[model samples]
Target: MDLEVVEGLVTAIRPAANPTDDGAVLLPGLVDLHTHLREPGGEAQETLITGGAAAAAGGFTDVFAMANTEPVTDSVERVEWLRAHAPGDGAARIHPVAAITVGLDGDALTAMEALASAGVTLFSDDGRCVDRADLMREALHRAHRTGTVIAQHAQLADLAGNGQINAGRAARATGLPPWPASAEAAIIARDAVLAAETGGSLHVCHVSTAASVDVIRWAKSRGWPVTAEVTPHHLILTDASADSADPVNKVNPPLRGQDDVRSLRRALVDGTIDAIATDHAPHTRQSKQRPWIDAPFGMTGLETALGVVVRALLEEDALDWQLLARVMSTRPAQIGRLGPASGRLPQTGAVADFVLVEERSPVRVDPSRHLSRSKNSPFGGLELPCRVLRTVVGGRVAFEA
Candidate 1:
């Protein structure tokens, strides 16, 4: 096969001849629809350079950087700046999602047309819910006109206030206010209606509740343009882990119960959930080493997502390779509107963005070894039976293990 690099772009085509028949599974490089790069601010925790490197190492060729940064990406200038300033050497391509509201305050809407022209394909008020119904409707309407997707964080501020974990026996046992599942389901249901009414694409981010999955399923049955994602933590871990007071288990849309995890896995297998996004929120060690209540809500996920999927879903044959490709790469690329130029698949003319996996290789998760600046994964030390051996972006090997 001939691999060529032109003007910093990599392209991979048919090789001359096969020397070794090493059975390596070739899949499209993963695309994370939701990630917190923390650049343009919050650099102490993570910067574009470090986060992009981590993404490449995790086998991702493209990542949608959420706009909830220090300065908040809301304007055309800021969006352009982010796109131009992305780390070019990283394994993954970085696409910036502009905030739906100015400063993500949920007060005034941003310039949808200008941001879209600046290459912002997704808009979100993440890290906080857009509580104003009228404002949300307006944002959806604008997004529809611009052909951009609005990704909701799906948390009800009132119900999720100071919520430490999922609302269940686990939270009750810990004396922490529960983050009721209804808090997420309600927003998803409402947003589905808004999306249907406005004919806009609405994507629910980090969906953690069984009821939320049901809502998305119902919406799809009606042909509403709505999609949802499930995080690896939610699929594998439960609020029961929070009983240990380990900050690593803490996250927004907090780790749910075993029942919820089962339901999420079922949804993933049945195509009820559209994709698996990392929501890769990184925090410094000092930030996560505090009391559970005081600790930040997030965990670094890029490097461990595939292994988690293999362990939780593949080993049981719950999801096959095709389904994994859809959830991890195809669906996310479609949702983000990141065309083939940004690494969708490994077609002849397509950008050579793909990952090589040693399907039988065993993996031991190690936070310290992660490429991300933060080491806050709950899955650290957990062994899985597969590993991402190499990640190629534009036909260039961005990362190799």
Candidate 2:
């Protein structure tokens, strides 16, 4: 296949005169609905430039950066600052997500209308849930009016207080505080109903439990405005991974058991889970080097997400490249309101954002080679396939291998 490009757009798709018989596949650039480009105060962890590089390296053309930075992206000024600082040379497009509540305190709503007018399509108090039911309901109603999406972190602080790990054998074995599956499920249940009640679009982030999948399935069964994303880690890693006193395994919504992993994989393939979002949280090595209890909950994923997902799903024969494209690109673009039908295939007049990948022997993950500022990867040493050969954004090479 040959793509004719002119001025950052695909002018035509024509058959090559002499196609090289390489095993490489060309795919639409992946889109990530959840990524933490920790700038402003957390520059020590990650910044826009580094994070964009990581995204491009992983075959992503677009990323929705979460609004959990130092000053918090609750205002138009911060949002604009983020847009202004985004790399333009040859990096993935960065969509700045605005916080749902002022200061992410969950006490009051941010200027939703104002932020949406500034081109922010997704709102969330990620890393912290909007625990107040009244506030979430109102936010959902407002989001509906603005034609935006309300993404929930889906954790109940009260129920998940001081939770250190998944509430099961891992927690029992490690003697750590247990984070119950109900904590995530309960919030999703409430928010699904609220979304249905208010006719608002609700997105569940990093779904990690079978119970949560069941709730999402039920919500979708009702045809409510509810969609969900599963992270690469959650789809592959079990809470048993946390059984060893490893802080790298610590994460929000903490990893679940193998049963939950199986359920999540099934849900993704069965269409109950809508998309695959990285939730690519990055933390400083110094912070992560502390005691397991004191270290932050996160892992850098943008650089390794595609490989991890490929390893997780290909084993079941449930993931064809088309399905992978849907979960990674098409569905996520739709959820982020990138376009009416954003993640389109390369065609006449389409934006030239796509990737070339070759299925290769399993390659062990090495965080030291990551483009991100932080090196808190949970998949280090894990062998994964599907090496990205090239990534293009706006007809320019963003990454080449």
Output the number of the lDDT-best candidate: 2
Question: How far does residue 316 in candidate 1 sit from its true spot (Å)?
Answer: 3.8
TM-score of candidate 2 on Cα atoms, chains taken together = 0.97
- The number of the candidate with the highest TM-score is 2
RMSD of 1: 2.3
Model 2 C-alpha lDDT per residue in residues 58-164, reported as the tens digit of each score? 99999999999989999999999999999996799999999999999989999999999999999999999999999999999999999999999999988999999
lDDT of 1 by residue, 1-401 (tens): 44444544554455646545556777888999999999988888888888988988878888999999878999988888887889775357888889988998889999898888877889998898998989989888988898999999899887778788888787888887788999999989999999999998999999998898889999999999998899888888888889887888889989888888888999998989989999999999999999888998999998898889878896456758888888999888888897755435455555456788888888788899988988889998899778888888766778998
279: Cα error in model 2, Å: 0.8
